[model samples]
Target: MKRSTPQEAPEVQVETSGQLPPHAAGYARDKVRAVLGQAPEPVLFARVRLARTANPAVERPVTAQANVDVNGRPARAHVAGHTATEAVDLLQDRLTEQLARLAQHWEARRGRMPVPGSHEWRHGSEPTHRPDYYSRPVEERQIVRHKSFSLVRESPDEAVFELESMDYAFHLFTDADSGEDSVLYRSGPTGYRLAQVHSRPHPAGNVAVPLTVSELPAPRMTVAEAQQRLEATGFPFVFFADAGTGRGNVLYHRYDGHYGLITPAE
Candidate 1:
């Protein structure tokens, strides 16, 4: 596992039109007042903008956020909501309650609770229902098929685009020369990881490779890092890992060894 010092998120610049929305602007005002231990008087509200997850077709509810300029500095929040109205209400209520409480909390603990932001969680144990669209008729199914096929021996990048185009969470491919096997998979917060097969892959192919390829544990990184690392490694001849999410983050289960760090690959 590669460890690097953590860096905080960059500040957001809030644009303005010499006005603020009633709900959006008030929410910001409330947050500042919360910390000041008084009603909003000197504070000036700049702007309120509505932002949401890019994809709307997915069944999962989208999250909304707000960026407000309090006094002359910037204060922001990324609260949860499925709709604009719901998001506005959430911001209103949260700002109203917390701003006043901020001063109290800070005084008591010498800090304000870390403002909430987007987060994702992973699950444990095996899935009871292994749903399959591969078998389901295409007319009724979203996924047409997960046809098992062979790929020309090459780097993992060639295979990654294949998965992205097909919208696959993972892929099994042939390695150059050594005829070794590996899997490119995505699970949980860890977008994707490379697994070089050091051992046998799942035999049935009826489900996700039941077998772990590498003994190394999963890595803590983003999809981009995973691909970069695999490219750097020159496709070592070994069994690949199965990437998935857990309580911590996306992890990779090695073919034989304990799942280790799957950190961002430079």
Candidate 2:
């Protein structure tokens, strides 16, 4: 079936955490996390600034950004609010609905289940209409966004140290020698790298789902090496014939009832 454009899909942005004041910064920060975290864990970005809106002399508003990873392709959800209550709203309806719909696409492709929007509601299923509901488009979409992050510059040792210390799965950095953008991080059993080429433009509006991506082992990559390394892994994935105006991505997973092994790629 046809799916709505990414613009139609709620833009999923990782929470960008902003800066806070000394006396109330930590406390407010904790409160913000507690409130926003009420929803299931998903990659989010929160940009915070601790500054006086009225005073031009304030310290640059103390602007900073904090981001969490999504299940698939590390999509981000923005969580920002004047108070904690507003932050919580982003998690459930907007974030949850988008992820669920994306997952449904993958499950349908796998022939494991019906499209998420379809069900016999007339029978007995309660109105589970979630908040931040997204309308489905009317078109056939079989494939979604599938991308890999390759690494550059830092050696494997530096990459491992930074990722481990920060407790992050992947790091997007520019290569010193090749001067190209690359990703270094872990996924699955070993570390993996993707040579991000200017060729593969960022998909504009596809929703990203939370998938189980671990830091895989890797020797890091130069731009040239990463492209050659493509298709080396046996991870089975289907590419969409029509990637759409922007990058279209869906999270496919193995079925175990309602739960499935979610892969970040199409």
Candidate 3:
């Protein structure tokens, strides 16, 4: 008997968080669908969200967000522009780059093509999706909240799973491969990225070995489940993946104790 290949399922979904023109919504949905059609593997689903920024005069008032689910893996990207159509076009390009990389990684592993033998492949290029604010000179920013937490040991994929399943802007963990302190953070609209913490710079000008942070285990859960956990623990915030989009999100307790949401934007 011969084994049958699993069927592919690549569906595109588009919805607006705020009031949006029907043409804009349709354009976004169509763009994502056309891009995913080129994916080497079956994209489980792709979701696009469009919204207008509060600042009317902003150069990029129209924000577009796209989330792609490949197999059980999730990837997200976003872009902004003056119009929904322009934003969606850029969003498609970003999504194409992401899916291309995923395809490269998987294909290389399967020996389908010569392992990516480029300089960027050997030495990872600086991520282009990071926000512009990060490049600006550091201002008088102070650590408003400093709490020590144990560093969990996990792979990059597992780290993302943990980060999404808990209420934290970032997660510091020991890389299972390198055994070094690593930070997983959501840098702007590029989704999640990992940084290796070499050494801590002391405020007083002396280097430190860093506090022996304790590891906080995170369990994968849906957004609704995360909200329930947040309410049960009386915690200020809860982080988890949106079941519908497979994207990370934060549900926080507002001043009035009502729920507030924070999600990646372009």
Q: Pick the candidate with the highest lDDT.
A: 3
List TM-scores for all candidates, in order: 0.27, 0.24, 0.52
Off by over 4 Å in 3: 1-9, 114-118, 121-173, 184-266
User: Which run of 10 residues does model 3 get worst, by summed lDDT?
Assistant: 202-211
- Lowest-scoring 10 consecutive residues by lDDT in candidate 1? 125-134
After superposition, the stretches of candidate 1 with alpha carbons farther than 4 Å from their true spots are: 1-46, 52-56, 60-63, 69-74, 105-266
Residue-level lDDT of model 1, residues 1-266, one tens digit each, is: 23222222223323222223445445544443343334222234423444443444423232333443333433344444554456556555544433333333233343334422122111121121111111222133221122333444644444443443233335556544345455665443424455554433332222221122344533444443544454456332112233442111222222122222322121
Q: Provide the lDDT at 44 for model 3.
A: 84
* Model 2: ten consecutive residues of lowest lDDT: 253-262
> How would you encode candidate 2's per-residue C-alpha lDDT over 164-235 as one tens digit per residue?
323333445543443434444444333333333232223223212111222332233332233223224322
Model 2 CA lDDT for position 247: 22
Name the runs in model 2 displaced over 4 angstroms. Answer: 1-72, 88-93, 114-266
Note the Cα lDDT for every prediction shown: 0.36, 0.32, 0.56
